[model samples]
Target chain A: MTGWLGSLRERAARITPGTLLVRGAAFVFAAGALLVAFPGEILLWPGAAVALVACGAAPALAPRTRLTTMVLFLAVGGWIVATTTYAEPVTWARLATLACLLYLVHTTAALAAVVPYDTVVAPAVLVRWLARTAVVLALTVGFAVASVVGVRVVSGQAYLVAAVAGVLLVAALAGLLTLSRRS
Target chain B: MADGSLGGAGDEDGWVPTRAFGRAILVVGVLVLLAALTGRYDLVVLAAPFALGTALSLRRRPAALPAPELSTMDARIVEGDDFAVRVSVANPDPVALDLVLVRLWLPRWVRVRDADHPYAAPVAAGSVAEIDLSGTALRWGRHDVGPLSLHGVACDGLLVSLRVECEPLPIKAYPATDPFRADEAMPRAAGLVGQHHSRKPGEGGELAGVREFSPGDRLRRIDWRVTLRTRRVHVVSTLSDRDAEVVLLLDVLHEAGESGGTGGAASVLDTTVRAAAGIAEHYLHRGDRVAMLEYGFRARRLRPATGRRQYLTVLEWLLDAKPAGGADQPSTGAFGAHLLSANALVIVLTPLLDQRSAAMVAGLARSGRFVVAVDTLPPSLRPPTDGAWGPLADRVWRMSRENVIGLLREHGVPVVGWAGAGSLDHVLRDVTRLASAPKVGRR
Candidate 1:
């Protein structure tokens, strides 16, 4: 049993360091951003800030510490979202800020996963990352604005279209994760 | 492991996903579903950026392999000269590669001037991106520059192509030495044709003497001034200028002391090779046939030849010398008197560490060939240890070496320590004088 556990640990370690932590941090930061974006959620601002900071600082810590911090911050974010009521209406500005913050969280993790602490980030790599980030941010903000306007304009059917879009998004995310794992 | 594997010259394929895309997709998908279920539209807006990024990345296929070619400015460089190596990457497709990383493997003796190796650049489709690496040649001998390594990524940073390695390029660096010209006369002029004044009287430019015209003498050879004064015709006799054969016997039996490269004190082998090059350059410059015999290892021989190009051949062979099997035992049977032309000058370059070489050289001198043993022992060699006994032992070894040198001198083989230009001047004159004296035939 101990040998089996050791082998399992070895296999987990073989996965790129900080990959899981970064992924988990992305989820937590997005959740925290959602809580902060909702109306009357001023108290959850600290949680969102804490999640962002943890993800940004995750690259410098040991794998175990990063893993623990990511899990704990994610649980805190889940708690913040669960306690808040679902009746709060969303605004365009709040939704845009949430999209930007979520993008930042994802980017922090993605950048940390590729580069190790000892490595010097080449200027070419940095420029490429920044360019890609800009494109992704532009696309996400455009879609987010369209979705918000669609919800306000077509109140009844907006939920049905969102459910279908949500299902498609889940499938895309699952496929992407599988593809990344295979690579 | 990454660096070590990259050191090999060749192409390899590898792929790594930008976790940013995966993380964004996964995080946004879950958040979008939660928002849709709870009738919250703001979550859809938050997921849009990641969703768009993933869609864009997955929509386009990865760019085709960017084949790169590596070339150096010069294939050969002299010591202390700069060499430029250029790596050019070509994009085969219409799309552009955002960032590419290139690493070059460098040998120990080469130093880059700009330290611009491991460069990164963006290459457009159908366009070539180039990186120039300039370095200096720090030491002599052939050195290999690289097997170029390349890493390329696409615009989205989602896909990384394989690490491509190219073959290592070779740079031949020739040993630089001071200019050497021998002013001393050759002991004997053996060739029937070419330069250098021979003692024997024959048809030539330099007047040896004027004598009463003989029956066979050409009328044009008559010295007009001397013939007018004598009334009877007097003919001018000149010393014939002919080429001489020079055989350089390089002793490679033993190599002592450390070879501190070109910057520090030279080892025994370094001294031997350099001195041989200098002497060969001098003789070949004088239009004399020069050959080389590397002894004290497996015997390597070069046939006697005279020309400007022959010097390069001699140097190339000399640079390949290494301390190998013993050349002292005379087991090869190739180092006979026949190898040396009649009256050819035999120069034996040895460290004099092997006592048997001394006897071998003396035998050549006794056979009527002019032999000169050049001592190539480094002058600045230190003792084996720093203790008192080390100095004493060194002195004792020196005294014994002198004794061995004395024995060679007794047999009429003049042993001279190489110290640049005029080192062979005195001994060459002595050998010339000895060659002129009347000799008794071997009984």
Candidate 2:
């Protein structure tokens, strides 16, 4: 498992600086388009943009950039959950959710294209990209849905959902680690 | 020669902390102050110190480092053997460096097995650090060993270190050849001269035939006393002296084993080297003066001599020879000059990969010198294509070999296809038989 992780890190290092800039630009453009489409919705516009930029640009940057992007993505997700609990259905919220979904697909494709495959291929690379995209998508949808239902789920339920998601993701990673070791 | 200068003639000595830890503390303190002032608490807490540490780790100043000088300890090394390369780093600064990182880049053919120091260490001022590196010679030829890079840092991670560029060193790896075994028997030509005694009679020295004395015959060769016993006037005919010179021509243009085989130990070049070594050693043992010429990137010659030492020298030369690139092919005039007066039995060991080499060999054979070509091509490395270009190229090569053989045969030269496996003796015998036959007219 450590070997797989190390290989993944090496592949990340090999990505050229130019490729990172181009992918980042594309993600920023998509985020800008999302913000323009959903004008007044405070939660939808900024949150979707941040999530999209993070997902697209994470693979291209150095270790520092990847960590920063992930942190920004988590912060934006937390803000969306906090803000949407008291708000009613807005067209902009629905549009923002749709925009986030589309951005996720675009970012995944962009990241996959730049991943260096010359050396050893590891499962962690695919798993990490998929897990990140899935988590962001799930959070965006859950918060948007909570906003729509007109029933404010307690902060305790939100924490419970987050805990379960974290455990499942860990289990999946552990399973992958064990499978890789056996092979 | 100024005060406060780093390494000039006139400077006062002072205790300066060159530790990386001290530098890191300074950077952390700056970051704490910046965080306190900016109120960007999250970024100041998360990024500042890590950023500082990374910058410190990769920091290098151009002027503060010592330049490294590289010299070849041993230029030529034999394949499968260990050899040393030395590099000297001189520190001109008055203040000592805490840690120094020396990174040496090696060529593709050379593999580093061991070194004196594998990691960074401290070096004092006005001192030189001489590093001795040892590695196995993985391939033959002239290889560049290093442009040794030096990275020095203080013990405290506050400031960026030093970076210096060093000169490159050349290492030549020679080919390895063993002594020839006497048990291996090769066919001996009749009436051939110098040291080996032959049973057949010839025109000088040994009495070969008894015939009636001709009018112009030397009186000393006449049997004058035979007249007294009613014998006819007779004369003694002696065998003529014949000295055969053997020239071993090695084809070093290209090596054969690029294509991976299912399972095999030796490549085509290995087989060729062994065969050439065997033949050259055999000739040298027989009191025959033997010379060697290598045809690769450039042509090299070792003049013919008969002795154990001469044979060893030739073997050593062969081991170190490398294949030259296609651009290095000699001019027509140079090729002509090299082969013009070569009267010895020229034994060419080659894989016959290109047309230029084949043409040159054919040209030499056509010039009436005794030529024997030992083709080193294995069947496995041939391209597996059925198209016109592929088949045509293969056929062209095959035809070139055949044409060379035919040309040599027309000039009474021998051509042997030594595939380096199975029965080499049989191949030699067959080639010898063909060589001995009357010359065939060229088509």
Native contacts recovered, each model: 0.35, 0.00
Please list the C-alpha lDDT of all candidates, in the order they appear.
Answer: 0.68, 0.51
Model 2 lDDT tens row, B80-192: 67777776777676545443456677777676653322334445667876666677666555577766776553322122243466766877665444334332223334235
Model 2 lDDT at residue B171: 75
Q: Which runs in model 2 stand beyond 4 Å of their true positions?
A: A1-183, B1-64, B67-76, B84-94, B114-118, B124-133, B178-244, B252-288, B294-300, B306-332, B337-343, B353-363, B384-412, B419-443
Q: In model 2, what lDDT does residue B245 have? A: 61
Clash pairs, candidate 1, are: A140-B48, A140-B49, A144-B45, B10-B165, B14-B162, B296-B327
- Deviation from native of the Cα of residue A156 in model 1, angstroms: 11
Docking class of 2: incorrect
| B1-443 per-residue lDDT for model 1 (tens digits) | 12112122222334444434445445565668676787555555556666766666555434467777878878777666788978788877576775566767788777775343355567776789887778887766777877777766653544556777778778876665645556777887876577887778886776798899989999889899988887989998888877898999988888888876667678877778877888888888888999998875467889999887988888887767778655444464766776778778988988888767777787788778899998888888765767778878888988999999999999998988888777888888899889888888867
The parts of candidate 1 lying over 4 Å away from their true place are A1-130, A147-165, A170-183, B1-48, B93-95, B114-117, B209-212, B230-232, B260-264, B325-331, B334-338, B356-360, B366-368, B386-388
lDDT of 1 by residue, A1-183 (tens): 999999888755554333444445555555555455433454457675555455444433432123423532353344335435544445666567666665655554444433333222345555666677778777676776777777767865767667766776667756764563443
Clashes of 2: 22
Interface RMSD of each: 5.3, 17.7
